[model samples]
Target: MRVHLGSDHAGLDLKNHLVSWLTEHGYEPVDHGPFVFDALDDYPVFCLRAARGVATDRAAGLDSLGVVVGGSGNGEQMAANKVEGIRCALVWSEATAKLAREHNDAQVVSVGGRMHTLAEMTHFVELFLAEPFSGDERHLRRIGMLGDYERTHELPALPESAVGLGPDA
Candidate 1:
């Protein structure tokens, strides 16, 4: 599979490690930026670029997916998610990685290099790549709602009672 990789200085070492490992594992790893480590580099610059590439490929008439990383992965994941058509998941474990892809259809797995060992990170990547989205109707509908919100900034038309919030008195 083709995977885009991006990371700030905090996650640079892990990103580089994954790139070399991914190459050896028979998967195409595309680097988005920060070819050389730079302390001043920002996660949004590289993360958003990677997310855009993955999201645009399918939109701009190609097919691709990606991964982004940083110290806690929280900011990077949020940054990537800001890009249209990109679903980046902050995965810290094998189960979450699998669930992110299988249930959320997440195209990008965000990892925190400082959060785990190199072996754990590798396992997270393996789980993410191994799992496929279930494509169940409920999941699809929910994703659609989020997409709609992305475009309109309006509340989803679900029953407020079900979501536990009655009409705003």
Candidate 2:
């Protein structure tokens, strides 16, 4: 698998560590990075490129995924999601990592450099890389709804059970 990585100054160390770890695990790691840390560096500049790398590789039928890192990972996740056809999830734990891949079919995962120890974040990345999407009917249907909305800008029709359940109700 090809794993694309990006990060700001706050996450430069972790991102660098992941590159080495990913290669050691037999995965190709592409670094879309600052290479040298600059305190004022922006996460979006690198995260978007990492996300696009995954999107492009997937479009070409290659097995690829991405990781974006920052102080809190929130901005990086948002930046990644701005790319068309990219599903980027902010993952904070083992369960979130697994669910990001299995349930959401996320191609990119965002990690908070300041939120956890290096070991913990590394474990989360490992779990994310190891999991596969479930492809269950319900999951697929929900993914389809989001994709439809992305392409058409049309809201999905409410389910029968949700039709009348609003704030006014």
Candidate 3:
């Protein structure tokens, strides 16, 4: 699998570590980063590029994923998700990592550099990379709904109950 990584200064160290770790794990790691640490560097600048790389490669039928890191990972995930066809999940634990891939079929994961120790964060990434999408019919249906909504601005019709109307109304 090919993995694209990006981060601002706050996550430079973790991103670097992940590059080496990913390489060691037999995955191709592409660094789309601020090669030199600049405190003022923006997460979106790099994270978006990494997300785009994953989306493009996958669109071309290549197996690719993305990782975006930041102090809180919130902004990085937000930025990555802005790219159409990219489902970037903010992962804070092993379960979340697993769920992101298994349930959401996310192609990108964002981690918080300052939220956990190196070992913990590394484990999260490892779990994320190892898990595969469940591919259940229900999951596929939900994913299709999201993909369609992404491609078109139209919202899915809400059930009457969901819209707060009585069932018979």
Candidate 4:
């Protein structure tokens, strides 16, 4: 599988480490980087590129995923999520990593560079890459709804149960 990676100065070291590790583990890692870091660099620039790479590849039926990292990963995750057809999840634990893939069918994972040890973060990435989407009916339904909304700026219909619960209720 091909994994696309992007990061700002805060995540440079970890991103480099992951590239080597990912290659050694038999996965191809594409670095969409700030090959040379500037402390003032923005996360969105690189992260959006990485996210787009993954989204385009997946749409072509290729097996691909993405990772975006930053000081707290919040901005990186937000940037990635802006890409159409991309499900980017901010992962902080083994469970979150697994759930990101299994439940949300996330194709990209964002991690906080300052949050965990290198080994711990690597393990989270490993789990995320190893797990497969559940393909359950509910999961698929939710994903479909998101895709629909992305394509059509239309909000999903409210549930019948909530229809009567206005200020008057």
For each of the candidates, the C-alpha root-mean-square deviation to the true structure, in angstroms, is 1.8, 1.3, 2.2, 1.5
- TM-score per prediction, in order, is 0.92, 0.97, 0.94, 0.96
Candidate 1, residue 39: how far the Cα is off, in Å = 1.7
Q: Could you say which candidate leads in lDDT?
A: 2
C-alpha RMSD in Å of predicted model 4 compared with the true structure:
1.5
The local distance difference test score of model 2 is: 0.95
- Writing each residue's lDDT as its tens digit, candidate 4 over 1-169 gives 9999999999888899999999999999999997887899999999999999999999899999999999889999999999999999999999999999999999999999999999999999999999999999999999999999999989777778977697534
TM-score, cand. 3: 0.94
Summing lDDT over every window of 10 consecutive residues in candidate 3, give the lowest-scoring window.
160-169
Where does candidate 4 have its weakest 10-residue lDDT segment? 160-169
Cα distance off (Å), candidate 1, residue 155: 1.0
Task: Give all candidates' CA lDDT scores.
Answer: 0.88, 0.95, 0.94, 0.95
Error of 1 at 86 (Å): 1.0
Give the Å shift of residue 38 in candidate 1: 1.6
State candidate 4's TM-score. Answer: 0.96
